[model samples]
Target: MSLFGDDELPPVTARESQLDFWNQVAFERVQAQFKSGSMHHALLLLGPGGIGRETFAQELAQWVLCQNHSQLDSACGSCKSCQLFVAETHPDYHLLAVEDEKTQISVNQVRVLIESMQESAHQSGWKLANISDVAALNQNSYNALLKTLEEPQPQTLLILQAEQLQQVPATIRSRSQLVALSVNEQATIEAWLAERKGGMTEELKLALSLFPQAPYKAEDFANNGDAVKCGDFILDISCLMQGNESPLALAEKWLPDIEDCCLWMLLMMRDLLLLQQANDKSCISLQGQTEALTNIVNILNNQRLMQLNEKIVELRSLLIKKSPVNLSSSWQALLIYCSQLAQKTAKSA
Candidate 1:
């Protein structure tokens, strides 16, 4: 199981091959900064989840703390510090993240890190910290971190991994130098999945479109096999949105997994937008739902369709927070939204 109790993310060693390119790029950048004497106190790495930002951060931390660092570039991997890092017991390094029982990174955790950071490194060299998913910091936690970032310790390297850069404060963003790691191109992701012998689904594609920043989460959903069925259900739901037929009749029969249904709603909204904006069916993943796509296109305008997608995102986030989510009500609201959109479009035409 992963940190969130989700049985996603292949074991650490399995992820190495997929992360080579990203790690090389990040390592080079860090080396360049070190050579130029322009290394910042905090480095924010913005990227999609599971495409290796966290892994790269770990490798970079190793490079920074390696005792046999003869070059400004790479870690010797055989050095004492590198050995400790590989063993996950490096005294000067820390990883701050929302572990079990912690919904968000709290001020107390930040305080503990700050106090530890104030001391000299165990090896009397660089202090490397990886704050995985910095966006998990609440307002209070963010404020708590401000003083630490503003007056960082000497020879300390802070690597922050965040899927949502917007959630972080402007002040914090400005204080850190950013290295943006983008969503792995389809080829990259497909290749990674291929290596893992993991199967993909249309739901995975839909999830990619809906949650671009967290492709592995989508991959996990796809691997479940149940989510693939939910994809079919969403296509049916899209068809039902075309007429006066009540989706409520089928909702109880088909909504086996509430999370999957909500995810389907999110993807359907995305498909609605894709149909509205893009003419080339070959360019996007529509899962051969062209008839349903046509119906949605005839109904939704760009803005309202976008708003519908936003609502789905809101619902997904609520579910992630373990909040009590009402999927049936959300689905009913979506049906109403689509029906109104179709009616308005027909009237205008």
Candidate 2:
């Protein structure tokens, strides 16, 4: 499960292949800064989730603490500091993240981390702390961290990762230097995925499109049999709209992946809306299922699609917020609405 206990978001990959391939450019930029003595104390890595920012941060930490080589721009795994880091017992490196069964990092966690950071590193003099999701820090937690952000601890590096910058404060943003990471080379990612055994080229490419800028996530989707699951879901949605599948059964069947189901519904509705609005297939996201999506476009009007979209959005918000909700029943109503809308349109035709 992902940090949020949802499979919709992919966990950060520790694969050396991905950490090196996807983030080499970003890594080199920071390395250059380090070599030139211009590296900032606080580095904020901004990117979409699953693009290897956290892995880059971890590897960079090891590289910084490695005693054997500073010229290689990477950790020499045989070095003492590198060994300690690999074992996750390095005294200088700290990882701050949301606690289990909790949504956000607490102020107390921040205080404890900050207190430890004040002390000299027991092994390497360099102090490194990585906040996995800086956006998950609440206002109080941010306030608790402000002193550390404003002050300077010699050789201290704070690696902060955030998917949403709007949730971060202006003060924090000003104090940290932002590093952006993105990938537009679809062919390169596809080529990489093709090299993996048990991965079909066609399905891999389809997953690639679904997770834009997140190639590793696409690979995870394929490896976890999510592509097949998603295919079944698409078929189920088509069957529902065509008045074949019952909404209750489909909803119950998909209850375990409720959040993902909501997301897929939203994306499907988004595709349908775009198809109706622009009359262009390129405007839709589910490119592999153009025929089914086109038929969906005909099954519902813009107003109905928008209505269904609003409900999906609301339910997804509730799920992400961890609010109490009757997901199975709610999803059944959503599917039933789609079927009723299709039946009404068919009768009119």
For candidate 1, lDDT tens digit of each residue in 87-161? 889899999999797678888888888888888989738897789977787778788888889998889888888
In order of listing, the candidates' clash counts read 0, 0
Clashing pairs in 2: none
Question: After superposition, which runs of candidate 2 have C-alpha atoms over 4 Å from their true positions?
Answer: 1-18, 100-103, 166-171, 198-200, 239-255, 270-291, 302-349
| Worst 10-residue lDDT window, candidate 1 | 9-18
Cα lDDT, all candidates: 0.69, 0.79
Off by over 4 Å in 1: 1-18, 183-222, 226-230, 239-284, 295-335, 339-349
Which candidate's lDDT is highest?
Answer: 2
Whole-model lDDT for model 2 versus the true structure? 0.79
**Candidate with maximal TM-score:** 2
Candidate 1 Cα lDDT to native: 0.69
Residue 111 C-alpha lDDT in model 1:
82
